[model samples]
Target: MPVVTTPPFTISSHETPTGLLRVSLSGEFDMSVGDALSRALVDAARRPGVTRVIVDLEHTRLIDSHAVAGLVAGYEAAAAVGRGFTVVNGGGLVQQVLDVTGLSEVLCEQP
Candidate 1:
């Protein structure tokens, strides 16, 4: 699949050197993208050897509460299966959301 998705938002995934599933998100993150984000995370978390999942949001330009909710849902789904989940590489609006919601230190720890 293409690295940048066509609708909702762009999503790309790969295995990190540390064997973690790294999902990169870009473009607009809103109510429309919420369900898609959850589905993507679910797929990533279930991959073999994917003991951990990292959502890299460095390129994400915008986000809404529903998108954040999807992130939380993704976290919960990963946790349920003993798979670790974290949002990373956040900046700008992405970082702001994580901070405003007090998830900066919880879901993300990027500087």
Candidate 2:
């Protein structure tokens, strides 16, 4: 018999003195955690005194359509409230997904 275990996933957040809410994602990100990601982004954007929300994907190993959808939803949520939203530090597969989907231009900083 064989057993399979999924990689660990986590989300952590902090706020800077300038009202920037930085949310960091660790491990894999996919449909399993899509709802959580959306909720976190929305909540962060709507928080009192938060002027912007940035999701850090530097440590994420994987991402799927659901994750992208969540990001879009978060962006929309932030925009609806006049708050800025963006994503940063995504690389490899995660970066490719965002680029191929044309979301990098929308959610990430241009270089």
Candidate 3:
């Protein structure tokens, strides 16, 4: 059998307001990238003064069910810590996924 490798997706985080952390996500979000995404989200949730987290998926090209699960898990974890978690600026394919899955309401978005 030949060894297989998965492509990498980009995930970056930055502080916004006094208690807000913005996580910018892009590229394909699939099984291969799930672990990395989860780890990054967990780290961001644990940061001090981060009472809110906004996951920006505007530039994301693809997302699978596993990726949605990861986002939900991250949201739950943040809520457990009394923090807010939101998904913002998603349009086109990204928006379609959230809408069809009924996650648009569950995941907050910016106007």
Give the top-scoring candidate (lDDT): 2
Which tens-of-lDDT digit does each residue in 1-111 have in candidate 3? 111234657787779669788888877898888877776776677678899989999878888887888788788889889998999988888888888998898895635
Candidate 3 weakest lDDT stretch, 10 residues = 1-10
TM-score of candidate 3 against the unseen true structure: 0.86
lDDT per residue as tens, model 1, 10-106: 9998896676888999888898777887788777877777899989898899888988887888788888889989988888877888889987777
TM-score top scorer? 2
Candidate numbers sorted by TM-score from highest down? 2, 3, 1
TM-score of each: 0.86, 0.91, 0.86
- After TM-score superposition, the amount by which residue 91's alpha carbon in candidate 3 deviates from its true location, in angstroms, is 1.2
Backbone clash total for model 3 is 0
The order of the candidates by lDDT, greatest first, is 2, 1, 3
Could you tell which candidate, 2 or 3, scores higher by lDDT?
2
Single out the weakest 10-residue window by summed lDDT for candidate 1.
Answer: 1-10
Could you tell which candidate, 1 or 2, scores higher by TM-score?
2
Residue-wise C-alpha lDDT for candidate 2, range 1-111, written one tens digit per residue: 012124577788888989998888888878888887777777787889989999999888988988898899889989999999999999999999999999999999888
